[model samples]
Target: MTDATDMAAVRVDAPGTSATARLLAEAARAVDAPDLVLAVSRGGVRTVHTGGSAAPGPVPRELLTYELGSASKPYAGLLLARLVAQGRVRYEDRAADLLAPGLPVHPAVRRITLRHLLTHTSGLPGLPADFYPQAVPRWSTGPYGGYPADRVVRAFLRARPRRRPGTRWRYSNFAVSVLGHTLAAATGTPWEVLLHQQVLAPLGLDATRVRPGPDGTDAVGRRRDGTPVPALDTGGFTAAGAVRATPLDLLTFLEAHVGGPEPRDPALNAALTEVTRPLLRRGLRHAHTHTLTWFQHPSPYGRVLFHAGATLGQQAFLGFRPDSGLAVAATATRRVHRGDTFVATAYGLLTETP
Candidate 1:
């Protein structure tokens, strides 16, 4: 198994095979994810990052530190599916059954099942209103700075249903975070341990770990104003969003989902496919469509399995065409404006083949 230090030296050698490489390289320069971008293919991998930054220098392909943000949901969904396959839990199991007793106060919430939570059909809002700060941080840094799990659970208990369970689609971090807690309770293991054993270790993804940087090791990037923003730990929300992985490790995981010929547990693979499948069409009121964990956007290329993440000033994007077996993963230090240049570049790569 390779350690983070060894992985940091890994780089892409297949630049010529990817027709999108030059364009992606240009996009990486445009956004400030350390001016770094990685494009991976079956034959090889290529990395491009702008120079002249901190002492650690440019972001290395092997320095395993990336905040996956909501990208962790797909992994969480896989773990739940594994429990289902083991007969330890069922998709139809209600939230009340999985959660600590008497926690949910809403009558309608009792009807929410594991599947509903995984698919974001639990009718729960994105984040509890009480947790919302009236003012944005002067500088966008670790938005969920002090919010902890206990506070999250307290706010959730007081939450009323936005729509009946399974009636309409609404994204809820509270729901997924609760799902992680529930899984931990059912299996009697830390959520991170479960992920490492079931997902990372199985695929030989040694660099992928739940903690921000294994033993305080991390990659550095600058904020928009040219201030160095060290990677911030997400605390207990690791299951909901705190996963740090290198582009190669991420590509390895995506390859498994896209049917790359790696020895993966059959049950886990099936669960991955099931989760990525479109569960329901959200009402028009919501701005976008969603799959179990993936955000769906119609492109001329085909349906794309994609998720974008933001933490403090850092932003990341992962997208792949499962049918075409092509994937692109990009991260930036400065928050790329939503629907900005980075996204456009990612889509351009997804649609164009080598």
Candidate 2:
């Protein structure tokens, strides 16, 4: 949906935003990138800032999109929640039940479920061992760009888990990739179509797109050596991580997560609630639990839900306090020594007062 909120308008130093704007500016300068965008919403107020760019243009607009990388998991998780809410699929349903016929797999693969994949307890490794060899050669475009989905399933079938399913928490791009394929097969819809219909369209995220097209307006992913890299093409693995969106669009998504102004779609709201609900506890520094795809941390002010995503040359982060109504989304064009500093700064600003 097109918003009347002008993309080129100047952002004012409104109450609750001055401090964040200051911090965001610092993050933009600290990161080693040609350009970056920072957007945030707190207590119903919104702010946007852009820094550093190679394009002979003004600061990046809030509507200019960036690769979200693993941040796409939340979108995949939300789609699962919507299907479950529709009674079309169940969290406990075995993943193996949804695959195409003739696919081979170990018996343990039959026991994995949507819940297991969503919570990162499916026992699947972070990736197939062969993933790197296949991906590194084309790191400029996308490691897995145009990768075959059937091969992913075949590799998954032959692989054994490090531990029993649900016995421990392990982040697996493979698990989510499988989940996305299974969901698409079950619904008889492409993963991208399902996400756009169920989530983006209803929320009016017109600027957000999967496998971002070759539009010159989108931010370029720059290598450490300053060479330009193509945007990620997840191919059949779009569900695992391949969302491209603008800071404005991302803030709109985060707004929904933190109960900011949003559309009156009840199903989307219910699914979002499910996505944010803590389903399992994951013991880690700062983080305490896992939601559908978000990591939940115990903060002195309240529960903080967070997630970070990175591709070959891009990094993205989202964090928010559901109780305090503070949310942040940041994106950088280049992955470099100072890349991490930008995200850490965003988080610090999100949780602390001015």
TM-score of each model, paired residue for residue: 0.84, 0.90
lDDT of 1 at 352: 58
- Tens digits of per-residue lDDT, candidate 1, 175-267, equal 887777767777788788988877777666777777655544455555666676657655445567877777666766676667764534555
Among the numbered candidates, top lDDT falls to 2
The lDDT for every candidate, in the order shown, is 0.65, 0.76
How does candidate 1 fare on TM-score?
0.84
lDDT of 2 at 35: 70
lDDT of 2 by residue, 1-354 (tens): 234244532263433467767766765666666777777777757777776656635434555678888888888888899889999899998777787455666767767888898788899988888788877877666678646788787776677776778888988888999898888888899888999888888777777888665556677777777787876778657787889887877877787887866654666778888888878775766246888889887767787888888887787888888888888888887774543576776676566643
Q: What does candidate 2 score in Cα RMSD to the true structure?
A: 2.9
Cand. 2 TM to true fold:
0.90
